[model samples]
Target: MVLHDALSEDHVEELAQLLALIRRGSAVTRSELVQSSGFGRTAIARRLDHLMALGLIAESEPLPSTGGRMPRGVYFRADAGRLLVAELGATSIAAGICDLDCRVLSSREEAWDIAAGPESTLARLEALLSELLRDHQAKVWGIGVGLPGPIEFATGRPVSPPIMPGWDRYPVRERLAKRFSAPVWVDNDVNVLALGELRAGVGRAHSDLIYIKIGTGIGAGIVSGGRLHRGAQGCAGDIGHVAVTDDQAVVCRCGNIGCLEAVAGGAALARRATAWAREGRSGYLQQRLTEGGDLTAATIAAGAAAGDTGCVELLAAAARQIGDSLATFVNFFNPSIVIIGGGVAQAGNAFLASIRQRVYSRSLPLATRDLQIVLSSLGDIGGLIGAAHMVVDEILSPKVLSLWIKEGTPEALAGAHAGN
Candidate 1:
């Protein structure tokens, strides 16, 4: 029996076009789909049948043709299944599920303990997924997990990430795959966030985009030619370690000195705030210390929003550092849009304005001319959505389709299983 891989390498080009046409909300006749997809009629018919059977596509009523026989049109089912996503942050993990059209289904936020390590954190993640999936037994397509550090793309394992300990070469994909008994994909958190933005966030309008995430750590996910550039080893956007300030005093999580993250991450901001409060230099943060609240990125952002001058200054400095590093990226990639997100991005227009001004000032005139610098459109949802996007993209691959059809969907189809 042949496996039910949805799209093979040969069918990828056509699948992409079909997805595009369906996404456009246009009623497309077979002839139109063929012309747009450049696929032979038989091939297109076969693929369309597979997609229709999978419930990803639906046939609309036949449209009347004035001068010819009526042709049936097809469109994408935006609510096929809920895509579950977990956007792992430095201090927290935001879990969300969405449908095919990238609309959020449900989301939950949980705190992270720095000393918890990978095993403990994974346990928490397992609990979270268990609860979310059980609650919505139907409509869950798969699970997508985003990490706060560099991930080996091929193996879906963490590769000596700086901030996250006890996760080196962790078999995240294998573990998740076993738990869900479904496709599980792992990716660098920032890259997934960028992908989320590319699909439905602010970067949607731009084909070439660069997404930088500044939080407890800073990194980027570069998208060029309408695809994410993961570099040779999936470490392409490790800009957090990029030297910016040249101060050899402070150490970074990546075992480096004077790194951009060391100077501008959320932890750095909190440390500076704590130092100022200890010196009695800032009364704003002192109130927090007195109240026994941990000086974190969220607290600092709140302080800055409340007219705390010291907090504002610290955030501005971080923005400057981020802009300086991005200037290099701007020169190298020259993407049409650059999006910044993460905890720091919650600083609102003040943070965005500062970064935009600096990037424009530092980048070459030609590079800056058409560049659009803005905050992330997905906000906190970027990571979750990106994770879901990864799973969806993979499950739609030909190889996965073959295996799933051979092992899972066929039996499901035979038994008339109502898979959500």
Candidate 2:
């Protein structure tokens, strides 16, 4: 009901610091909290009690110590609330219902067209969420969505999304908030993929990494200093439009010529494969194209696996081209890891090897020295998990906590928790 019993600024600051310490496992017991936070014993005890009362942190079983008395481990209460996530792509969508910890309770994928615009796609996603929430009997504290285009992060609206027609500047947050009674977050789908990898996949080890998605189109998600970097206009990693060739013949979805996506992405590779088959360069690819009615990145990979040189060369060239762009990024960002994912990444080791070879050979020695080029560990569901994580991060931040405290923990804020 938005009732007010506002917390003082000092109280809110102390809560935020304590929350971070507990969540990050830097401090658990009163002694540890005192040492890390430098708060007096009474202050630590008081903050801990308040957090427990707010259903934010919980003390689990004590750790087994070598010789001293055991101390209980304080952890964020993941089960306190739930989140709904929709990971949208150019041709499909994956949605999930997850806990505050980003654990997927129930998840599913369905074929969808981003070109179908926001209205129909949003409705379908809500329908899926409704079904899942009903079955699980879960209440939503927040909702997260990853769209296959640039998003105006502050407003949760698409901005000049080439693939998402009729969705430009659409009020995604406003519409979704109205329907679900929760805060909503939106971002480019690849950014979420990077996030999913960071939390649940290979990115668990490395703080700095570049996540490249080479599907129907190509995009990169840059994680710098362990955080997703969405640039000034939320198009920081829009590398698809970056020119790879000067040839005027190659055209991209955004109508630009020689863009990387037009020359080396899955769609581009498939188009090249088809042209080769029609020209009878590879009889195997020709027969497969005839049988399947079209050539795709997957089919081309299969052909390459079956010893088709043309298919192999096609992939190698694409990989080299992609690697050239990646080399530039590696030099520019000097990330510790470079994860390649999506349809083209699944084209087998040869494709990966070619890209790695090109990147290592082309990039500066310093950047390449510590860089580890690898395939995505999350595979298909990374975006969904990332979306959930994004919402969870927002709902639990200091500002959101202040809002909640000011509102006296309304029903919508019941399960929300965060730190400074």
Best by lDDT: 2
- List the global CA lDDT of all models: 0.77, 0.85
Say which candidate scores most in TM-score: 2
lDDT of 2 by residue, 1-420 (tens): 112324777787788888888876778877889999999998787778778777788888988777779877678887777888988888897888998878888998989888998899999988998888888776677889999889989878899999889999988877777777777788999999999998889998888989999999999999989899999988998998899888988989899999999999988988898899999998878998788777889988998999999888899999999999999999999999999899889999999999999999999999899889999998887888899889867766777777775543323543231100
Which TM-score value belongs to model 2? 0.93
- Candidate 2 pairs with clashing backbones: 396-417, 396-418
> What TM-score does candidate 1 get on C-alpha atoms?
0.86
Give TM per candidate: 0.86, 0.93
Looking at model 1, which ten-residue stretch has the lowest summed lDDT? 410-419
Q: Give the least accurate 10-residue stretch of model 2, judged by summed lDDT.
A: 411-420
Residue 202 in model 2: lDDT? 93
